[model samples]
Target: MAEQKNRFPLKRREFVKIAVSFLPAAFLLPATARAMALVRSPVRVNRLRPPGAVPEEIFAGKCIRCGRCVEVCPYRSIELLDIRAGVFAGTPIIRAEEIPCYLCMKCTQVCPTGTLQKISQEKTRMGLAVVNRHLCYTWQSMTICRTCFDVCPFKEKAITLDQLRPVIMEEYCVGCGICSHACPVTAADGMKAVTIEPIYSWE
Candidate 1:
């Protein structure tokens, strides 16, 4: 009788262990497959766009997903979301928090299509990076350094000199990434750079 009782418990435990192991796969597989399908299918028809002022027409019409943009991005902000859907299955997606774009224009420079567009620093408008006067060392009555303005390719334009201090012109800011890359304050307090959000959707 004792042997049988112990055997019963052992059988029950074995069943429970088996059930527990397979349960997770049952739930996870469907979700993982769906996500994979969404990324792999060409004509995504549900891809979410990046946030901020990116050119929708250019992104939709030109991006070829050659990985050049992601490869050249110094900050590694651009990444391939998936290889399932959208214009380019393995195209780059901007991950602002992990590695925000610095507007270096290297991606645009390497893009084979006009997706990234080719504009001189004088006419570059890849979104502007504005200084939070409250956060800026120069505006906060601290040291004086215009690293962002000096590094900007736009000559006396995109980021201009106001009394030898950097000032952003909203109309001219195109969210490129140059100022973000050159900002000396980025490593200190996550300041000096932020990408405009909610512009695109690759659902």
Candidate 2:
């Protein structure tokens, strides 16, 4: 009985030491998991959700992945993400460069869940369009390229000519990605001079 009692204290000490070693990792585990989730998530630049999408944080949980948005899109702009998208798999995504969202507002109307709230095309803020002056022919004085300006749905409101170079107006730009697809100048990396960025993705 005495021998067992003596060993109990030693076992307790070993357990305490082991638990202490894991304490720091326990504190860091949640943060590490969150960081890993962000890395593996489908959210990224140029990839837009259907118009009137809710914030990305709640999007996965709220979205039932029924593909209603994909089916209702008359322009065939929305596509379901494959299994490689991690938790966001089966969720609808718009690859503007390939098939830009036409802002027909059809997808928003078909969503069974509020993940894609119905809103006006003019009010939908899917993302923002950024102009890379270095790659832009008009900005760099290479050629008079007004393709982006001409293709923009908002035209004079979203994009305007400044000294004949296309300038993006953030407040009015809807990030529809039409300009990105229409831009004639393609960088060596295959990116357009004007690209839509997921500026409003997180929130």
Candidate 3:
């Protein structure tokens, strides 16, 4: 009993020494640590869909973050953007380089979750691509840059040229973002020809 009691003090001393040794590590680690930290990152989803369009609910609910949609996209329109709003980490964002979604529905086909469903290209209305008239060179009464109109895969309906400039028919426009990526002024002026917005039900 006495020996055990004596060993208790020694054990306590050993534990204290070990703990003290780790103190410097704790302090040093902070100094040497990089910017990486487990922060509560935000997830942004359904930004590509119309306001009420909830994609999270549409896809099988549990969408494993895989690059399937990005890989299958022929137009290279689908990309993974950093999570900024909800619970998701990195999710897909469409960038239209004047080649908006022709309603290919390929992304949906690749998506494991009903998140991206295999809907007909004709029926798919992901979102509407809005154009900023002021930033558009043609729309702003500048040189005729019909790049967006020319590149759009949608036949006669998606994008229409008026007065030598392009106008997006909200009903026909899908938030593909091809025009945004294809815009020549994007790099210099930081303006995109197309942007995604929630689907609106006027009725």
**Whole-model Cα lDDT of every candidate shown, in order:** 0.56, 0.88, 0.57
- Which portions of model 1 miss their true places by more than 4 Å? 1-54, 57-64, 68-78, 82-89, 94-114, 117-122, 171-174, 187-189, 193-203
Model 1 over residues 83-171: C-alpha lDDT tens digits?
44534456566533344555566776777776666655444443345566766667666778787777655547667878777787665
Q: Ranking by TM-score, best first? A: 2, 3, 1
Model 3 residue 128 lDDT? 62
lDDT of 3 by residue, 116-171 (tens): 65655545566566777877778888788987787666735778988877878776
Every model's TM-score: 0.49, 0.81, 0.59
Model 1 poorest 10 in a row by lDDT:
44-53
The sequence of per-residue lDDT tens digits that candidate 2 reaches over residues 1-203 is 89998768567788899999999999899978876764465756678898899998889889999998888889899999887677888999998888898899988888999899988878888889999999999999988989989989999999999989999999998889999889888899888898998888887
Off by over 4 Å in 3: 1-60, 74-76, 81-86, 96-104, 187-189, 198-203
Model 2 deviation from the true structure expressed as Cα RMSD, one decimal place: 7.5
Q: Lowest-scoring 10 consecutive residues by lDDT in candidate 3? A: 37-46
lDDT of 1 at 8: 80
Q: What is the lDDT of residue 192 in candidate 2?
A: 86
